[model samples]
Target: MAEQGAAERGPDGLSRRRLLAASAAGGAVWLLRGTVGPESARAIGTAPVLPGGLVPYQQVYENWAGEIRTSPLWVCAPDSPQQVADLADWAAANGWRLRAQGQRHGWAPFTVAAGTPADTRVLLVDTTRSLTALSLASGFGGAGGRAVRAQTGASLEDLLAFLADQGLGVAACPAPGDLTVGGALAVGGHGTAVPAAGETPRPGQGFGSLSNQVLSLTAVVHDASAGRYVLRTFDRSEADAAAFLVHLGRAFLTEVVLRAAPDTRLRCLSRVDVPATELFAAPGSPAAGGGRTFADFLASTGRVEAIWFAFTDHPWLKTWQPAPDKPLFAHEVSAPYNYPFSDNLPQPVAELAGQLVSGSEQLAPVFGQLQFLITKIGLTGDVTDLLLAPGLLRSLLSGDTLTHLLAGGLRSDLWGASRHLLQYVRPTTLRVTANGYAIHCRRSDVQWVVSRFASSYQQVLATHQARGEYPMNGAAEIRVTGLDDPVACGVPGAQPPLLSALRPHADHPEWDTAVWLDLLTLPGTPGLHAFYREIEQELLGLFDGTRAGLRVEWSKGWAYTTDAAWADPAVLGRTVPATLRAPGAPGWDEAVATLDGYDPARVFGNPFLDALLR
Candidate 1:
């Protein structure tokens, strides 16, 4: 149910079931049925009196994969912070719960749980429609000090663009550009980054998730004296600020002020030639001697990511380095989303994806290979691939003209501002569901983390393939970033986000870096839940906090059973809380208590948050 990526050949990047249903006789009407506009907003029976001067409408909810959909329900768009507060008060008074709705790019039920009926007493506060405001804050220390004050509805892309205009930017951000700033902070969204050898962070810069940059945040909280919810601002120095920093949608944030540093130019290089065996080889092994191992790139440049297609030998590896000026022979980019081949599907890939949607499960191998081939040709613009394959493979790859047509230009190497290179994922890419985790370990053991994950994933895939169950038809994505460090915010008594996955373990001070791993596949693929459950078990045992610790990424899927995600009672009740906070530690319990103290009536919580947070 994640909200990311899209396609044109089918509905939102060819969702398998949707595509099949779309191609069926008289199915187009079925697909178009129930789509309503704001003008058609309706209230169910016995609707309570809404706040004056505010309009309520019926809106359907759908996540990125269209997995968690709902019938038309109540929604509202508040134009200002005070209006949002008014809505919160109205919800509390009228027996309704308020859930902030951003772009709906997330997979988890942080916004609204599945199977929620049309008559439920839940009110969705649509932030993106209004309340988006961005400006620079002044008078921190002197003129050199910089910070951006943005409303919750402001998008990451717009915020980055604003900073870029002033030669100020954040150190890292997630790949997709459409995410709301409030949503990103709520789930502790992060990007791949860490300091290189002998590298020191500049003022106002931190190599952690976006939530770590908060200088202050304004939220709606219950006020005991007022006997209702009221708008309150919490500084990073306050003890209660820790809980609000990454509240996982249990709280509502209206605005945030984030520290920004001077923007740096960057050069990005793409290589689809490295074999997975060498790239993910054992640490210090001879196979990893070619200076192309993942660790080697991380050591030299400190910014890297790998996308390994299923059943493929070579992985598409990308490395980013600080480049003060555009490197000679590097393509200069003017904006974000430069990789057209990735943003849009090529002809062969679209055809294969259509076949997959048509229930041709045996084509998983062909689909994986085809994806890799398209990447190779699209990245380097090398048409020499036509003769490299035989039989059906050659026929499929023979359309070099179509590949180049889909890929606007060769993008093997590029140079630009950090945002252009850092944010490459666009909304037009294929939409898929992903299971995510952050593995905490010492920087020296990053190689071991990658090696173990790669080996275990191969074994799992082989087992499923042998049993004729092609559960995965997508790639394995890997990235690394530094853990959250409160000192980087340059504020005295500032506290780190207590619930953040990157929050440094109190007992394990040596764990400085977090390796982010995600398995991506189209939703509703057969046996995906069981496969994810096995992978989760393997990961929990492999890391086990002895050498490394494992935690779930709040935005993606986790806590899997045989049938679904976020459904395992043991994980939801005990393991997840224990992973975040030890029995005697000052984390999970403190966060839950602080949130409850702010919203004692649980007016801001959903069913999922109610069960998990407790």
Candidate 2:
């Protein structure tokens, strides 16, 4: 069970018959045959189904976190809706809880409990492989009159690639490429964009969250009599729809329908060694003068992104444009893909320069080992690499250290000797230096988040300076998008009557475009979070609740909590319907009454009717 992915779990834990039956009840259930010896089943209140030989528990569970493992009492991989329905029924009769697991990337224990039958008991519906159906559905009653219907198990990368093949593409997306559709939608994954004018915005809205683009969804609900009911909903229902979009199927998500845009090619440009202070400063301000200001740059380009290196005075900027005008081309640029200090490293660094410019996985191990060394001595690096190959030094530091170094360096350069008295100063300075500059290229619509994160051109220079980190002295691009959907989170006040009403003027196509702010930070530094928070707060203010807010990449460093304990119960109570609420099932009259204001019966429910009713 330890150190395994989903593909490696042992089969000895449960019986196939019991697993199927329990899974029929809508929860992850293990057959007695899979978990215990044939004789031990009696003690657990279930008889063992010994027909197929036992498989070891080690072979069944596969998790990515490496810190925890789970052994479901029953694991069911249902291929179709009917199979899912049947499994729900069986779990209800057997008194087992149901858990729908996808990708298993979550660090929390929401999917499986530890150290009890609860961990191995009940049925777990694995979505990793069961659902692979992907196709274009025409005349789907929505805008554009066409949509892409994806089964719950499809990967986002595959989905985008598939769509692109069909001459279509995702309007926005998160940075990492490996995320799955189900996982993204369930957890409210987001992308970055500036809302168009007249778009109602709110606090904390991030464009990367997938909930904004969902056109429709299908969920399997458990009812009072332990029967499974399928529920469907469209974009119009506000309260229930919003709740469903954010909810990760305490029931089950069977399908997702997304509204996609036509495929288009984008050109990309990059710049390195730019001063961070001048990049993100406010428009027309003195601090942002003598270089392309972030706002002005974004206004001129198709898209813009910026990356700043900590402990150094350079920021990388990238800009992209649609294809045909500029043609597609790949670069040999180096940057972090994940945190610089993550356990997953691409390779070990043999030189100081290699540490600065390599991507995240490649940089983390080097940074950690060197950081340990630096703790004993002082921060050390090759002087030649510091001046001529700063990227190599960046490849070696943890993201926290990098951020600190950059902030410290910026503070030192801007404020001179006065910065030495700060509270967070390091005992020793990083031995790296650089003269930042910009590179020009066309914009790309695909992989906007990645392009922005990696590119050094579009970073917010002023924010870095305010925090004592040197700002990139390059353009920090930003664009705006008009708010269309009322169901989308971050729109202030009640949901809009229709999305089109908020569209920008017809004369300007770019007027209503979503804003993308490119940013960069030093690797292995703790200041990244604070800097991000400040930027988020500022963006939320400038937008003035007229559109969706900023998008923070959760997998990278944004630590979001799924714990309901921290959630505002009143908000939940107001947003979720009484019938859909946990524990007590609503009476038929109550359900009907609840359905009166909103569209009725499209929402799904769980099969434990009596338990829900109680």
Candidate 3:
């Protein structure tokens, strides 16, 4: 099942029920029931019966977002496809709106209505518990390829672990471990690397956003003429395939079949306190390795990643090496997942000496505590300590928060304060900064292979130019896999490939590479959007000018403007479909049309999508 979002805490730290009650207190009476049609019943194989009468808001309050802690509603956790169909029928019959909730991980308020719908007037189908089946199937789509079918509720981390256990892995995956497969894919979550050759690139390629890497999907939708039905599609036809691959903005996905890769182990090395400007410089510079260009170093290396702490000169750099085929001792040495940063020394004086260097590491304890608090509130396991800490720092230093300063001139954001202090002590902190995560891997048949190689190389060059500084203090990671789904988003053709092709040979060795990047934004600042836009534009210009095969991950943000580039205008044409687009549906061209006139007051609409449509 998917994890729930963090809600406001009560006196005891648990979410307060009073808040939920308050959110659902005012709503009109609504009765919704489904009388299944013969065809629908046959397809669903028996309609699951639900309890009669209005479900109370208090019953469903636990599923609301933090912003709507006061919402009250009863959630019907459907157990099967049949149950979903029945609920759809009920909602249609009673004129009650139905909103699907998978893991309830989204930070937005779209999942629940503010007033009327929350008070038992609207119905919520909690799919997390309902769709718990995850399995692997072979020969389902030609021989030699494997398919991983996950019910809507599966978590990305769980799915990865499961795939790894089976000697299989996904082509690409998003960063957050707790995000639900359904939720992630719905909003177009993505993974690292660019799309491969012959692949249609999505908006953002580097982050490997959700819209890429979709093989086939099944969804239950309500239609005015046909009632409710299941829709399915595959990546056979170009337009239809691309449309289904991203879903544009259509039906809720109930199940997803992803192409899986063979399993392989990786060895990682990480270094903290690198310079930002030197990290992004071109290869062959003195500050760089001086042997091969920085890009060449990354290409020869298996994988490379960096994360920068805003307002600080030190960055973290991580590189990965494929594990040898021969066996190695399991106890070579490693840090506990709960304390990824425990053993790391303070940012090196060499990296920060001239730059801003803080006077003390006194905030380490509070930082650790805040990390614990964030995990507890988010319901993520303690295992996330390593992965989430950097993100917290990025968010805190990016000036996204309101608290600008603390008592006695301390920066409100701990990471930012540390960065400021570090710079105050070191003059080099004034240099431009670039920080984020990157991963390297052996390449394969996937289309993104070349672009992945190129981006990694480029990042290395950038690091060198900035003077040996990059971020990503954490260990580098590697995983192996055989090619599976060609239609998946991050693969070469789904959208724009993040990485570009290099070379004389189109087909190379069995090994490939995957790189990840995380750009740091200063907290309490407003330049993030501009920074991202500028960098993205520069990258696109370089790639396009050179005819490099690189593509960026669309989920982060993009420079693509054509409606057909990433969006399926058909499915997004209307608020709700006039005809239900079945699972695997390449929805209509109109689906995205209404986005041009989106209303924030309307549920399921956001500024980003609105901007995309415009």
Candidate 4:
């Protein structure tokens, strides 16, 4: 998760705090006792050797959050691309489903549904171990430009480390480094970034989500020319290839050649003093949003996020700007995961969590405040040390310091390569469910979008609070990004991501940006389902899909009805498909048809996919 603000609350930041808290509570506590592995092992007998050889299939397969568990018949760790192809062929032929898993950092069940029967004959293909092949070149296969050829199993952390060595980097990536290239691309994972004011868009480099950077991908799709499933490479320009770029795990990906750029230094700064009403004021409203509004920050830097706690006024606003050189207040760091308090649960939050676990769900409200208090106070201390250690006079940082320091509330400036700055979050971040949405609008309309959302969310939370139900335990995280660019893929006429929240909207030709929103909280809170549904209803009512439209983040939880994720038969069956296949969504239908034709057997289909696609 993007710890700068996503704290399990959304893409990353405090949304991650909810996750880290769940994980920190104790790994064993979350696991379903005497379930998952033993049952499967007893039924399946000894695991069988498959095309790529087997790894004994000893452990119970669990998602990163420990939410989903399964006992697979085999854990195939293929050593080469051919082995992966062979396994796919075998799975298709034997009527067995193949679920690919990398870091399993996401909550979505793209690989396998959580409650799939233990007795079912499913094979778990662990790509992170053996399929990690990477290579860098000045000019690569698809675009004849700078690129890196990496196996799907290669983690984003490793990919960036390799790029760092080669003096290259991408526009943006998910906050956590533990994600595999395959998993991140499958759902079109992204970071919050866009072109700054007066800046021209760059060729072969997109300030959009990570999926836009894919020049070409090699996957195990059924080739009509061949009698069985085989390794096939599709250039970004091909209409059918659009589906693979962000197919939500409907297809199996092996490797990709991603566009790259010469690395640049960045300055990441944080501030937590802006009042919510002023920062997210509605259009034409006299809310007197203090200093620079959220839009103003984006106009200058084009990369920023605000983490507004559920019940707190001050948001932990963070802005990352391009800095060619280190500044006096900037801390020089080479690696990521710099926030130790966030990485590990602090004592107070831990104790409160312990209490919450022991039938004190009323403490949920206190939990939210503690999250804000700890982050506010802890981050302030860190920034104070950064400001003080350099002998910068404390009195110089007086009233309205955020105004004079930097337009974005400069608490502390972290100077490092963009990759390092982007990934300071650990994998243990969020194990709880988080709901997310992306609103498509122009950069100028960002505040209107944010304000509308904030006002509505406040009302819903207030309603729940009146009923003594604190469903939201974290921040309603906000982030921004541009629509995915077709040119960056090096496809002569590539299309944008079909399901990307930032996909260019036909009705809003002037709207080139997307506003990401998320509210994070601990799992198992009473009335969480009903609470989430109300928020969903409120967001849908406000955005309304005309000049402003709505879409769900692929990786996080969504389609809430009764605290259950991907529930709501209407949403699962109708809304998602209709939205993704909205008017002007280039090649969306062709992409689906191509995938369907390739996997006529529907081997990748899960209950979620079948329902949505039906």
What would the TM-scores of all predictions be? 0.93, 0.52, 0.51, 0.87
Question: TM-score of predicted model 2?
Answer: 0.52
Question: Over the stretch 1-614, how does candidate 4's per-residue lDDT look in tens digits?
Answer: 12333222322122333444556644333333332332263545545557744444544565665556565335567888887778778878887777787887787777777656555667777899988989974455456347888999999999999988888776677888989999998888889888778865444567778888887789887776787888888877787777778888788889998988777788888887677877887666676444467887888888888987667777888888878889887878878776554555543455455445334656666666555555654456534432442222233233443232233322356889879888867854434567888888877889889888888888888887788777777668899988886766676887877666556765567878889998776665557778888888788777877658788888887788875888888777666666666464454566678779878877766666766655
- Candidate 4: RMSD to truth: 7.3
Tell me each candidate's RMSD, in Å, in order: 4.2, 15.1, 15.1, 7.3
Instruction: At residue 16, give the lDDT of candidate 3.
Output: 26
Better of 1 and 4 by TM-score: 1
* RMSD of model 2 against the true structure: 15.1
| Candidate 1 least-lDDT 10 residues | 24-33
Number of the top TM-score candidate: 1
Candidate 3 lDDT over 238-329, as tens digits, reads 33344333433334567776655554344434444345444544344455454332244354442344443333333344443334342242
Model 2 segments beyond 4 Å from truth?
1-74, 105-122, 193-209, 223-227, 231-239, 249-251, 328-346, 349-614
> What local lDDT score does residue 499 receive in model 4, on the 0 to 100 scale?
62
Residue range 454-522, candidate 1, lDDT tens digits: 999999999999998888889999999999898877778888899999998988999999999999987
Segments of candidate 1 deviating more than 4 angstroms: 1-48, 142-145, 397-407, 583-585
lDDT of candidate 1? 0.84
Candidate 2 least-lDDT 10 residues: 412-421
Candidate models: Cα lDDT each = 0.84, 0.39, 0.37, 0.71
